[model samples]
Structure formats: structure tokens, C-alpha cells
Target chain A: MKAIILFGHGARDARWREPFDRLAQLWQEQHPSTPVQLAFLELMQPSLEEAVTTLAAKGATDLTIVPVFFGQGGHLRNDFPVLLEECRGKFPNMTLSATPAVGEDLAVLQAIVDFGARAL
Target chain B: MKAIILFGHGARDARWREPFDRLAQLWQEQHPSTPVQLAFLELMQPSLEEAVTTLAAKGATDLTIVPVFFGQGGHLRNDFPVLLEECRGKFPNMTLSATPAVGEDLAVLQAIVDFGARAL
Candidate 1:
């Protein structure tokens, strides 16, 4: 089975994770067949390694992580890969991969533009 | 005239502003009448004050700022309001308002979900 992890740069304020939680809920509601998990880079619970381990235990052999960040900065380019590699090493049986930051996607950018337009 | 600012949490890596740049470009192309500017909270050029000044000089009396961040963290909740108020003080003639982070929009979140599904 395949699973997806929506990874975010966690924040100190507990309310910061509200959108990430909503995203996960939306994914589960839309794609009930695919198990989804929320993971954080820092200042949050369920680190990437833990999320992967949970999914692996749930029979997820092919896993994909989507970085729900606006930019591919040091966190995504530097810190995220190291964490992913560690998870891969720990979960040797499961295949792990990741996508570029969601901001890199044209559709996501368009959606943001639309949001800004509507507000104006 | 009315204008918009795409405000983002800047990073040390210059490339981190690519998506913000694209968002501004898209806004300009789609809404030629409404001017748009890109601003960064830190580690980048054209701070919110600079962006507001530029738009105000361009005859834009009303402005809207859209935080291009995925979450409403301390940066947005705490730092951003101060910056916006400072800009408003500096450009008292211009009306400045801000929308919630782009991630707060359902369409933006749905677009991210679609991106992840396509990648999977």
C-alpha cells in the first residue's frame, strides 16, 4: 500500500498547525483509500521519522512526502533530505520519496494568486 | 488606484523568492490595472515599507497584502502586524489591509492536495 505524509515547518504557536491538520483531513476525506499523516520539521510533534515508521507499520511500502512550505530554503534543501535519508535508512523495507515544496507547483501558485485577488 | 503586495518570509537563499516573484508576475498579467509588489519579512529586499512606498507613489491609494505563507505562525501573527502598522504609519494616505495567510484559503489548500495526489 502507498501512503502520503504532509510535512510542514512547525511553529511555536499551536494554532499554526491548523491548516496542516485541515489539509490532512481533506486528503483523508477525498482519498480515503490512501492513508495520510501529518509531520513537522520543528517545534511540532510526529517528526518525519516517526510518521514514516507509523505508515510502514501500517503496510505502506511506497510513501511520498509533500513539503507544505512556500519556499525551498535551507529547511527544505538542507534539513529535510537528511531527515528523509534517516527515515529511509531506518525503514529499509519501505520506499521513500518526496516532492518539491508546494509553492513550486504552478497550480498552487495560481491558487494563491486567486486568493489574493479575491481579497482585493 | 488599488495595489497588492505578496508578502513572504524571506530566506538567505535568494532563490527562495522565486515563487513570490512568479505570484507577482501572475497577478500583474491577470490584473493589469492593479499593481502588485513583492515584499519579504526578512533576509530579502523590498521590505513591506518599501513595497507600500512604491505602490503609493504609483498612485495606488488602496492596498492589500497577502501573506504567501502556509501557516500563521509567530512571524505572521506577531511580526507581520507590526510591519504592516509601520507601513501604514509611513504611508498614512494609503489604505493598507492584509488577508490571512494564503494557506488559510480553502482553494489554496485544495490545490496543494491536488498537487500531492498528482505526484503520488
Candidate 2:
């Protein structure tokens, strides 16, 4: 089965969950059959390890990793690679290719500039 | 005086604020006596409007808005500009120059790529 994991920076204020959870829900709506999961680097439950394990448990050998982050910061650069290393060890049989972070994607920048124009 | 407003997406888990708060503290340490303010686009208090006014209230006519966001997501594209427009009406005397969102700027991309290389 194909499984997708969306990672986000964890937060203390509950409101921070709105977008993450909303995106999870929305992405699911768009891809109904894919097994989707949510993970955080810190300060939350269902971390990267847990999310990977859950998908593995469901017999998802094809995994698409998506970081729901705005930019490529420490988490994207350092933390995620380390997480992926552990993931490789745990799910040796699974095939994983990470989607570029939201920050690196061009469509995202377009959306941002398009929206920011209102300020002018 | 030059005042800077650092905007971040607030979160429920305190860990989310670490980078934001830490960056704010770091910038202040670098530029002592140059009034700096922290605000959130959402999920936190002392929001954009408040931050602008706070800087204005402190008699800061030259405002440098540095979005602490990782990318040019919704806040940079949508909310921030609207906030800035209102700021114009409120603080017309203030000279505002917004740096490109952290996402569009090349330095940020290098940081993300440098960090992600570890995963390989």
C-alpha cells in the first residue's frame, strides 16, 4: 500500500494544530485511499518514529514523506535526515522518497506573492 | 529609530516557539537598543497589528519587518500584507520595507538543502 506522512513543527498553543490537522484532513480528501499520517519533530505526540511505524504496521511499503514546513530550516536540514536514517533501519523493506519541503516548491512561492500583493 | 517586527505562527506546544523566541532574543542581542517586537500571524497573542503599533508607540518611524516564517506561506502572502495595509493607515509616518519572505530568499534555500543533505 502507499502511505504518506506529513511532518510539522510541534507547538504548545492548540491553535497551531488547526493548520496541520486541517491539511491532513484536506490532503486525505484529495487522496482518499492513501494511508496518511501526521508526525512532529518535537513538542507533540505521534512523532516521526511513531508515524513511520504505524504506516509500516499497516503494510505500507511505499511511503511518501512530506514535510509540511514553510522553509528549509534546522528541522528540514538536520533533524529529518536523522529521522530518515532511523526509519531506514526500522523499515528496511519500505521504499521512501521525500517530497521537497513546502519552502522549496515554486507553487508555494507563487501563492505567497499572489496573496501578499493585497498589502500594496 | 529602526524597529523590527518578527512575525511567527504561534503554536500550542511551547516547543514551537523555541526558534521564534530564540531568534527574537538573538536579534536583540545583536542589535542592542534597536527596538524589536515579536508578533504572531495566528495562534498567539501580541499579533501583527499589535506589534506594529507597539513599535510605532515606541516612536519607531523606520520599521523593518522581518518575517520569521520558514516560507512564504499563507501568513506572508495573505495575512501579513493585510496587516501592513492597516499599518499604513495607522502609522503613515513610518517608513516600511519588508524583506522578501525567508522562503524566496536564496540564503534560506541553501540552509535547508545543507541540512537535508544529511538524510542522504
Candidate 3:
């Protein structure tokens, strides 16, 4: 089965994980039975390697890595590439597709407005 | 000069700070005369109180606190408001207007698309 991994920047604050977990749970509510997992670049557990290996062990040959970051700034474009490169080396035979980081979606505009969290 | 405070979730990993700092610098580049400061909600240094106190000391009466978070998730909508409430009490006479958190702007759509960080 295909697996989706949500990668968060990972924070030390326990409060920080709440939203990420909530979103993951919300995503699961829509995709019940879908194999989804979480990985942190740092400051948290389940490093990218750990998440990838776990999914691989579970027979997920086709994997999708979604950067849970806000923009395509350095993290999504630069650091994440490095992270995925390492993951790619580990799962060479696996077909992996890295989705654009969050906030890269046009649809998110309304969500932002709905949240009333917009500037200007 | 006007002042702006960018509040981050504060990650334990050094890598996570790069983007926030970079953006702070970029914003500075555009507004050379403006005094921009960085604060962390947790994990990092320069807490909200510190950032605000520094600004207040510098004669900033009309302040605008910008949540550097991605969405209105718990931190932006919940925790941050609480932080501001505390600040409001501290600066009772100060006029502070909080802009929407980042990613809440329609203009950010292009940045997201430009980053090619979209999932769908």
C-alpha cells in the first residue's frame, strides 16, 4: 500500500505538536485506513530516516513525502531535498514523490481567511 | 522608525532557525529604517516578554505583533492571543494591532506556488 509521511519541522514545545497531530488526525478522518505517518527533521522523534524505514518495513514501496512546512523557503527547497536524498539512498528501489510543502496550496488562501490569520 | 516582531514557534534544531532569521533579514532589507525583532514562543531565546519589553524601551508605543506561524492553528489562534493579552496588560496604554499570522494572506499563494510546494 502507498504511504504518506507528514514531515514537521518539529518543536521542543509540547504545545507545538498539537496542531500537527490535529491536522494528521483530521487528514485521517478523511482518509480512513490510509497508512499515514509523521517524521521530524529535528527537535522531535521519528526522524526522516526512522519514518522512512518504518514505512519501508511495512511494505510501502511507493511513498510520498509531504513537507509540513509553511513555505518553499530554505527548509522545503533546500534542507528537505537533502533529507529526501538520504531517504532515497535508503529506499533506492522505492518510488517516492515529494509533495510541495504546505502553504503552497492556493486553496489554503480561504483557509487562511477563514482562520482570520491574514496580514494586510 | 516602525517596529515589527516576528514570533516563531522556536525549534530545538538550529536548522529550523535559518528560515526565520533569513526572513527577518529579508524584511529588514526592504525596510532598512524599521526595527525588526525576533521572539520565540518556546525552545529558543528572546521570549515574547523580552521582545516586547525591548521594543517598549525603545519608545515604540503603537506596536504590531505578527505571529510568524503558518496558520491559525492552536498557537496562532490560542496561545498567541494569550501571550498578547499578557502584553496588552503590560502595555495597557500602548496601541497594539496584531496582523494575521503568516500564510493567512492571499498574496502568499504565489509564494507557495513559486516554491512549488503544493501537494495537489
Candidate 4:
């Protein structure tokens, strides 16, 4: 089975994870066959490794990790690769891959623009 | 005149602001009459106050600030209100209002879900 992980930069505030939770819920609702998990970089539960383990247990063979961030800063550019490599090394049997930050997607940006336009 | 400000949490990496720049460009292209400016909370140029000042100089009497963030953490719930108040205090004549974080928008969240679905 294939799985997806929506990775985010966690924050000190517990409420910070609300959107991530919502994202996971949205994914699960729409893509029932492809199991989805929410993972945080720091200051939150289910780090990337933990999420991978959970998915691996669920018989997920190919996993795609999507960084749920607005910028490809040091976290995505520097830290994320290391974490991903570690996950790959630990789970040698599973095929793990990642996409660029969601912010890089034109559609996502257009959605934000539309939101702004509506608010104005 | 009315204008908009796309506010975000800045990052140390200069390249992190690419999407923000693109957002401003898109806004300008699509809505040329309603000017748009980009602002950062920290570690980037054009703080909220600066953006407000720029719009004020452009003859904008009513301005809307859209928080381009995925979560309403301390940055949005706590830090942002203080910053907005300071800007309001300085630009007393200008009518300024802010919408909830873009992440709070259902359309934006749906767009992200669709992006993940497309990637899978």
C-alpha cells in the first residue's frame, strides 16, 4: 500500500497543529485508500520517523512526504534532507520520497491570492 | 483607495521569500487597481509597518492584511495583533483590517489537499 505524510514545522503553541490536523483529515476523507499521517519537525508529536514507523506498520511500501510549509528555508533545505535520509536508512525496505515544499506549487499560491482577493 | 498586504513569517534564508514575491506579482497583475505589498514579521524586509506606510503613500485609505501563514500560533494570535496595533497607531487615518490566516480558509486547505492528491 502507498501512504502520504504531511510534514510541518511544529511550534510551541498546541493550536499550531490545528491546520496540520485538518490537512490530514482532509487527505483521509478524499483519499481513503492512500493512508495519510501528520508529522512535525519539532515541538510536536509524531516526528517524521515516528510517522514513517506508523505507516510502515500499516503495510505502506511507498511513502511520499510533503513538506507543509510556505518557505524552503533552512528547515526544508538543510534539516529535512538529513531527517529523510535517516528515515530511509532505518527503513531500508520501504521506498521513501519527498516533494518540494507545498509553497512551490502554483495552484497553492493562486489559492492564497484568491483568498486575499475575496477578503478585500 | 483600497490595498492589500500579504503578511508572512520571515525566514533567515533569503530565498525563502520567493513565493511571497510571486504572490505580490500575481496580485499586481490580476488586480492592478488594488495595490499589494509584502510584509514579514521578522528576519525579512518590509515589516508590517513599512508595508502599511508604502500603501499609505500610494493613497490607500483602506487596507486589508492577509496573513500568509498555515497556522494561527503565537505569531498570529499574539505577535500579530501587537504589530497591527502599532501600525494602526502610526497610520491612524488609514482604515486597516486583517483576515484570519490563509490556512483558515477552506478553499486554501482544499487546494493543498488537491496538491497532495495530484502528487500521489
Please tell me which model should have the higher lDDT, number 1 or number 4.
Answer: 4
The digit string of per-residue lDDT tens for model 1 on A10-50 reads 99998899999999999999999999999999999999998
Fnat (0 to 1) per candidate: 0.77, 0.00, 0.03, 0.77
List residue ranges in candidate 2 displaced over 4 A: B1-120
Instruction: Give the best candidate by TM-score.
Output: 4
Residue B111, model 3: Cα distance from true site in angstroms: 1.3
Predicted model with the maximum DockQ: 4
Residue range with the least summed lDDT across 10 consecutive positions in model 4 chain A: A14-23
Candidate 4, TM-score vs. the true structure?
0.99
lDDT of each residue in A1-120, candidate 3, tens digit only: 677787888766656665556555555665555566788888888898898888888888877777767456566767888888888988898877888655445344334333322232
Per-residue lDDT tens digits for candidate 2, residues A1-120, read 887887877765445555566556655665677777888888777898899899988888888787867545567777899998898888889987787675455444434333233222
lDDT (10s digit) by residue, model 1, range B3-85 = 99999889998777888888889999999999999999999989999988888889999999999888888999999999988
lDDT of 4 by residue, B1-120 (tens): 999999999999998999999889999999999999999999999999999999999999999999999999999999999999999999899999999999998888998898888887
Runs in model 1 deviating more than 4 A are: none
Error of 2 at B98 (Å): 13
Which pairs in model 3 have colliding backbones? A100-B117, A100-B118, A101-B117, A117-B100
lDDT per residue as tens, model 4, A1-120: 899999999999999889888999989988999999999999998999999999999999999999999889999999999999999999999999999889988899999999999988
Q: Is the docking of candidate 4 incorrect, acceptable, medium or high quality?
A: high
Candidate 4 colliding pairs: none
